[model samples]
Target: MTEVAGSSNSNNLLLEQFKDICAVDTEIARRFLTESNWNLEAAVHLYFHANDPEAIQNDDNARNEHEIRRRNVANPRNEAPANQNAVVRRSSESQLDTWGAWFRALLALPFRLAYFSLREIFLFIYALFGGNALAITNPREDLQKFLTAIANYPNSERINWFNGTYNEVLNEAKSSVRFLLVYLHNPSHQSTETFLDKVLFNKIFSDFVRDNNIIMWGTDVRTNEGYKVATSLHELTYPCLSLICLRENRMACVLRINGMHEITPVLTALQTALAENQRFLNAILHERAQRELDNRLRREQEQEYQIALEQDRAKLNERRRLESERQDAERLAREEEENLLIKKQHLAEIRERLRAELTNELAVKGGETIRISVRFPSGAKFDKIFGVDDSLEKLFNSVLVHATCPDDFSLVSSYPRVHLQCAPDWYREFSSVEENFGGTKTFRQAGLENSLVVLVRDNDA
Candidate 1:
């Protein structure tokens, strides 16, 4: 019981709200509110307000009268006694007219039947005599011909029509992110000429349609294609206009106007549809922009990654090259050190052989002895006893071992003015001794058998 009472209270509040918005009879407002699922706001929006703001504010009486009629139509059983009485009077008058028509038809039935029969017979005779049969008309072909005729007309050319199939136009509209405006024409419609001349061809209307990003498709109902579209849209009137838009991946009619020839009504309907669906269009544009931005950012990141990868590869190659060069240099240095050691060992062996030979030769008993005198650059003189078989290198060694400045001086024979070079080792023996005066000559062979004097002088001097 409490739930029921609460529901009643909600209903009462909605009805009161509707009444405040509509300024009409309470019952009429309640009916409209109920029709809109007891939503006061929707009822006011759909039934109370007019498309034009000025009309909504100034046409209270007209709106109330229309609402009253609508309310009666919605709930005839709940109409007032005066309306019921009027309906009863009209019902009686209709019954009387129906009987009178039946009586008159009963009297004229034979004559009418005979007239129709005679007309059929005459049509058959004319068809047989004229040597022509009634041609079966193709609605699609008729529609095409009609469209061709309209296309050739000077006035019809002003309105731009999409030159493609209906599906093509719809697909284009979806891809281009625009609205599709479909105009269904009927050449037989009485108001078609007026509508095309006064409203559709108006400069303002044409410009608006042309400037806006809208796809306009038009077809005549006489064609197979047009008939299919008309049937699908449930269009009951000729010269119908429908604004189709994509919503949530489906095409839906946003606005429809039928049998309207006036410029104001046509323009108003078009404007209202565009204004209401602008939000959906904006959402599509925003989503596309966001997707493009994301794609751009992803591309940039990929390019940066590619650059970084190449740089890393180049660095790795450089590091490997440097390591290879370092290994080569180390190998070369080791080889050079080994070669130097080998040369030193060979030189030592030659020097030891020379020393042993000289010692053996000098060990012979009663061997000839020579007195050799060597002088240093420091005004010092020394005398030594040396065997005749001894080499000049031995005497030079004795001088070098005792001299204070051995490296700076060369030994010279005073009478012959010959300089004797000192050999440091056997590896350089020939280069150290004096050339042109017998490089391998011994001290005795150089005519220094008895006593010889040798002087030391600076090598540079």
Candidate 2:
């Protein structure tokens, strides 16, 4: 049987080798996406967040479509709709209408910007239950026009009456309204006693009404309850925000007018509109916050899943390493056992060759030849040695082939002191050797120490 090798440390060596390979694989996996795009490649990473095989497939298709669209257009933002891109013809009338709409929108920029800013601040402050200055800005031409139109209504007498007893009506405006009313009245009539009377209570009453409406009225008086009281457009230039709401049947406007006075039905209507605006804004913000929270939770879950998967992979790799090492160890152990069996078999063969001489010694002066024997060729020392059995076989074969003359047989050193147990086969082989040499020798004549024997085959023989 062939001897096996590498019994002691091969398992450890194999584990070390596998660790090197796994480290390389991990490093490559980590950088794979970055190498392809030269960027973070977050999309590639996020693809794993779908949490379902089907969603992953659908997301891939969508991403591909987006990529195609982006690549087709030199400037993606400028790409018109598919249908619009095909239509190069248009009637002059249609073109004129389009141009007119564009022009109107362009002209409305200033008003839109002002209104939007006011709307946002109005909503924010209203949410916090505080006053805002957006609606209180310099007079808007749109608001002015609306006020002028309202003043021209047949209800002019009613507006005048409402403005006449401003202090008295302030109490009525607050009673049944669910929201505050903003009063944005013109400041053209500053000298009138009625307007002045209403103007006097502006600050005291600005906080009076909790209804959700802004009612803007006209009167030059700059300080009056429930009224934006001002001496001139320049004096009214100081912006102030107010809240207003109307009572049922729209008979009264509750005012939360702040820092301004001069009452009007128009201001009353504005207050109601502003309150509704604030409610809508609150709804949108709340919805947006909920969506953001949901997104964050989803991201956290995805990250946890990824981390778990990586940990599982690491454990799996570790198990593989352990298994590999175990196999290596088992293999080495089996090899060592096989090599030991072979060595025992070789020793049995040597003992069989020495048996006859050993039996003869028993007859002469001993009971049995029971000793351990070792053999080596001439020029081979016992000390500086390794691989004893295999080297002995090689040296024995070399001497049999090349040393045919006595002069060719070089005797260097031999340890004849080693002992052996001689079986029957040993007696038979030794008998043949003595007969072939035309001589016989006693075991004592061989001269041994510690009952150890070293045999040297005749090179020529």
Best by TM-score: 1
TM-score of each: 0.45, 0.26
Question: Which candidate leads the pack in lDDT?
Answer: 1
lDDT of 2 by residue, 1-461 (tens): 11223342543343232223222122222232222232222322322221112222334443443333223222223233442221111111112124544665466456556655765676687857855423443333434444454455342433322333333344444342233223344334222233334542333233333232323344322223223433211122112233333433333222222222245532443443455455544554566689889999999999999999999999999999999999999999999888667655654565454443333532214443324233335533221111222223222222223322121122222353332222122233223232213122234333322333345444345
Which portions of model 2 show Cα errors greater than 4 Å?
A: 1-236, 239-260, 263-270, 307-311, 345-461
230-346, model 1: which lDDT tens digit per residue?
878766455678888877767778766555446765676577568878889889878889999999999999999999999999999999999999998998898978866676566
Against the true structure, what is every candidate's RMSD?
Answer: 19.6, 37.6
Candidate lDDT scores, in order, read 0.63, 0.36
lDDT value for candidate 2? 0.36
What's model 1's overall lDDT?
0.63
Instruction: Give the lowest summed-lDDT range of ten residues in model 1.
Output: 85-94
Candidate 2 accuracy as TM-score: 0.26
